[model samples]
Target: MLDSFSFFNIIEQFIIGYFLTINTVYLALVVGALIYVRKQMLHPSVVKADALFKTELFKSISILVPAYNEADNIVESVESLLKLEYPEYHIIVVNDGSTDDTLQRLIEHFNLTETDIYFEEQIEHEQIRTIYRSPDTAMLTVIDKKNGGKADALNAGINIADTDLVCSIDADSILEQNVLKKLIQTFIEHKNTIAAGGVVRVINGCEIENREIDKIHVPKNFWARLQSAEYIRAFLFGRVGWDYFKSLLIVSGAFGIFDRQAVIKVGGYLTNTVGEDIELIVRLHSYHLRNNEDYQIRFLPEPICWTEVPTDYKSLRNQRNRWHRGLADSLWRHKYMLFNPSYKHIGMFVMPFFLIFELLGPIVNILSYIYLIVVISLPTYFNLTFILLFLAVSIIYGMVLSLIAILAEEIVFKTYDDFKDIAILSLFSFLENLGYRQIHAWWQFKGLIDFFKGKKSWGKMVRKGFKE
Candidate 1:
């Protein structure tokens, strides 16, 4: 019964509604951070490292790494942390009852000797068998504890962190040497800043020597290349924009720095949620606004952490599913924040955008595609009408974001040099919209289903190893 104009109108409405509802806030954030970046482009923190090493100005931080049977990269990960350029910090590695030789590897590498370190049992966690410290290297402390999830492991680390700040990194990820310095500067420069998240880059194809990224190269595997494109789109466009509006909802646990007291005040990390990083940030903002306290959480455009992307499809799917479930769980658990005026920016903008575009985005997208195909099958149909329109809209938006991310890198970090990489990246960005985007949508959709079914297992990642 619907006419062509009416049918097109429905599609138009969906597109316009999406733009006005989510993209506006996103654009606002992009513009805001761009302006901030342009303004502070010349600031010394943008380049220099020694300035960030001042003990009086820099905040003391404790780095927490929770390992679960990660014998492959445990020692290298710790060694990378030990070599960071920060002035004052402590490393706390939680051995979460690994069946592998994870404990022995650390002991042999770090020459760890057991110590009678007493920690206040502030947060409940599985019992710790022993705590060891490298007597020769004053900054290292390792906790041999029973198997608890990442959240519980982090909580144990938080209890023993005798510092003003805490930074959490994934067990297998490698951080840029200057990551802590840049993150800590934010806390020092901005008095109200509670947490700071840094950009994470793909290291799968990059030449990495001594646990640090030495060169940038696109992965030979298609999935890894797609992920590299995804990361560029995500960090540069998504996060930068979110932070600009002061409505950032999630800080990636890959490399995030937080105020110790603020995290502790909110009762540390939640053991129940897979997306504990996001939940804690949301709760922190909720408490701040509810109690009328001023605070800020920000992200830096600089690449602060380099992590391996899954080369094969299976591992990538698991990672995406876990991430999607995290989004769903965090959103559903904090559903009260949606449109609640008290939480202000987070309640009004961040929560709603996440629910609509991120949490339910998979279903909506899949349904829309299905509806388009059905419409095409009609006898007197407009072939290529929806197809062309969708391509025009998606490509324009996608390319713009990629370009911005590239621009951000060009202006700030300039990590990649080869002009050919830019062309390859550009092609990858377009290719991502064709099929990879839909695949991710399906992964997220599956995650939503698993979440409803009460799935809580941290899906394991099978690695081919990041050898470039």
Candidate 2:
């Protein structure tokens, strides 16, 4: 019995309601993140990198580099790892059967010689062809294995790791010299700390020399710049806020430190999902809670890793598609944790939030856009003033959140040194809400569709190696 006007009105109200709920949650997260970051800023002595390095309390770490067709950047990335300031840590690189000359390049550059090593098969992975260790340094080891996905490669590295802590990083990433020192300080401070993740910055335009980051600059490419803004917002508020609630779900695979024993205890990484990083963290939470064990997984804002981001739209779309699909797969795989009070905040709050907002947000956003266009185009269905007001409020609220994230970045890390760079980033923060957001939402929508279609392949991610 509803008329056309009534139907449109109901749709508009529903959209508004959805927007209100999502934005309200974001606002609360922003506030929580700001307070937590402010407190950390005031107490700078909580984890002193310098002091930790001088003391004997520093834990040994194993850096795991899983490379797939990374012939171009493998050498430089390994050299960078060799230069880390940590006192006790070794680098392990797993070559997952690359078609390129990745294994040969590592052998030639590092003078790696095949060696016999025995390791416990804690996790199932692809067959290992052979293991190589550097005779010159003795600190570096490389595993040549058959073609398996990234998760499988990581599991291979974890099997060979002898250290107390395992640090996972992308083959293309460049870690700061003191990154390990800073991350280990947390594990020392909190005995129950099982996992900790750091901020990952875009390295597209940064100046590098001798495998070290000499200077940081905003990327010249428009898409890369938009992603820079996105990273700042996500790392600054998203992870930090979740850390405050003790329900942190994701620790970026780009740079995350984990207790080796704990990871082994939880069965290591699942080889089937592309979002193996998030899946591992969620499982850790569930495992610890179910066992009634005291544990903490943290997201540190200080430790930084610089990595390349997609500059072209095609590459960006592929990357987002893979990421969104991974998110969907992980959530679906662990659906039992949703609203199960026995798991506490993680089960009742974080899991449900990711399901309602993170995974399905793109669908709602795309539908809202279609509805808006249809309503605006059809004169009989349109209510111009109401539509305009609704859009203005929605856009403004998003802009405000973006601005707050920017402010949080400036206050805490201030990674972008130049005032002009900050200004450009601020401008992009506003601009992103306009066109870029929609495009990103579309990519995620496509990802969800692909997920439902039972597609599991990871589309190609073309990376222009970091400047050196």
Candidate 3:
């Protein structure tokens, strides 16, 4: 029989090995993203919005906003979308039976009146209650539908959209003026590009004027500040690295552009899954690969879209839970793609990485922490020096990865102008690993449990709206 010391030694070695492997993968991703981002900086795609606006080179797009109890921010969000510097596009707002005054607010603010329009039902959706249009602004339209979830609401908008491309955005998000222009440039540059996503920065502390982001800064709230760093790390390294490998699985539902015909061909978003965005992208990749057709789904570092992140712990926890659950749902729904060479890198690399590292990462992290505590508490099995060394190395390595992500952000898009803001963000990047990361792991673990229990509902998120 193995003694406690030997048993713990074996467990410790395994845990350390696992940590090293995950960190090594992260380091590789950081290197890959840095290279890609550097190349982009050197040969930057010059976006001439004036020329694109004057010419017919850009395809027409329809912006879809699905609102469920978004009365506070609906008007501002719609106003922001109206000001997009794109030549040919219209806005479609779907009010998914909000108990709040979301629909009423739109009707009153936009001068919306009942209008009759015919649209092909390309995807399954709930019954439409009414369709409204604004006489003052010919570009705005609203659809009142039954209490269907976000996916169903988006499908309704997809069916109603009469444009070459469709852009899906949350009702609380604010897009930069030239966002569409930049996205359209990508579509024009790459004819095979069927879908693309933009970066979504937290707007909690941003200065807004006339429904537009006037200035950007890190949030005052500690939790929000931590989330700001998290977003920067995720977008700067995670998505960018995945894009570098050509195995990107998710284009955030907050702000993503898609080819209309391609989406229709794939049967649109999966209504039953919590992760409709990922499911749709995976299905698109699978469909195109199986059919032997050319297609490209990309993540663009530019073209910023600012959104309101949850400020409180409860809201943030709920949001993280839903996200993890969604990830599990999406991955399991497409399990056949795992290690299948026919789907190329997406199947062999992306799917496996997400399944092992992303989906099961929380469980491993929590278990390792618990085991470390247990070993440390037991004097017979305790190795104080080993525990201290292991924790110090783990934390320092995490801090280094966060710093690299921050460096990537600074190098590519210098969105934050203030040196003070940069310094503060850097500080939070290091601090996030201390306690926030463990809390995040716990939230994700709860999500995994909920997924196993067949929970499909998205928990409530209380939004305070963007600071005006």
Candidate 4:
């Protein structure tokens, strides 16, 4: 019933429709995020930690670090944790069988001695090699165990945690001094809060002095600069908007605070998927909703964590690949939640958006681009007005959203002091959409293919040690 011309027209329209629709969603999120962030800015005071200690809502916290071959930045990461401004919190560093000198470095730095600290094996993980405690500091403890994945390491840490909350952090991540105080506020205010995700800003450009972030500047490296803008878009608007919609599905593994009991109740992190972060959040939602429990998972718009983003193409490719594979793996594992009425917005809106736009977007975009190139090269009877409209809608529209995200960051946080930083971000916002987007899409597609081929290994990510 469809002719060749009609079929091509439909394909072209679909391409435009896909990008247009996703960007439209992004635009809505940006608006919501702006409204909420601006409102929060008016109330500049953060909750005082001393006052919270007297309240019943106050919960002791265990900062969980899951490390594997993080010799370069482990010491600095630990030092950062030692400096956080929170009351009644202990730091638990889980050394997940590092073949490198990761274990030796911690011992030398912290004077860690082996201890027989027993913990119940509530959640399954690889065998624990030994437990160590720092005689120098009362708050620091180390758990050396057989090589388990990140998820398994976190579960082990959760089991060892004697506190009411567990704050999972990457060994390379640095939390702000007041991050815990700010993150814990959600739980303190809303008694039903189970988990809260904080913003992860790129530390590549920022100046690190004396093992602390001293000055903020846009990254000089082109790749890092592009990612700086991407992070702004993803966090400032993307997650915040979803949070406003009450369908926040992802909390970055880099820095997130969770109730210890709630995590255990959901059966701990799943070691089976590389996307442990997303899967855990989705699982928490499914578990709470099914049980008819009142709970809230939040995304705090304030930039609370600063971590490195890959500046090189190879490392960037690996990160993006792993992320896509994780997305596919997580969605497939929770297929039962897709469009199910009982799951609420997670099933009705979030899951479907993830499956269609977030999961399959790379494939659709690549195929559509190939078609566009072929059709343009032919110089045939395609409508010129339609082609122009497609370019504007798909390409320019996304660039606008990126700029809006960058400007929003400027207005809300004022992290980048100089106006030129905003200018540079604005320029990269346009540039990234041109070629970088294509390459990123290809990497994500490869990840999806890797998922189908049953690849489970986390791709290698080389860390460029921060200069203190």
lDDT of each: 0.80, 0.89, 0.89, 0.89
* Prediction-by-prediction clash tally: 0, 0, 0, 0
Q: What TM-score, to 2 decimals, does candidate 1 have?
A: 0.93
Clashing pairs in 2: none
Q: Which candidate order results from sorting by TM-score in descending order? A: 4, 2, 3, 1
How many pairs of residues collide in model 3?
Answer: 0
List, residue by residue over 320-423, the lDDT tens digit for candidate 4. Answer: 99999999998999999999999988898899999999999999989978877777777676567667877888788989889888887887788888889889
Candidate 3 residues 1-468, lDDT tens each?
998678778888878877777888878778888888888777655445456556778899999999999988999999999998877999999999999999999999999999999998989999999999998999999999998899999999999999999999999999999898877777887899999998889998889999999989999989899999999888878887778878789999999999999999999998887888888999999999888899889987777889899988999999999999999998898899999999888888888988988899999899988987887788766788768756865677889899878866986788899989899999999999999999999999999999999999888898898667
In model 2, the number of clashes is 0
lDDT of 1 by residue, 245-296 (tens): 6778778988899888898898988888888888888888888999999899
Clashing pairs in 1: none
Model 1 is weakest, by summed lDDT over 10 consecutive residues, at 46-55
TM-score of each: 0.93, 0.96, 0.96, 0.97
Measured on C-alpha atoms, candidate 4 has an lDDT of 0.89
Clashing pairs in 4: none
Per-model C-alpha RMSD: 2.3, 1.6, 1.7, 1.4
The alpha-carbon deviation from the true structure for residue 286 of candidate 3, after best TM-score superposition, in angstroms, is 1.7
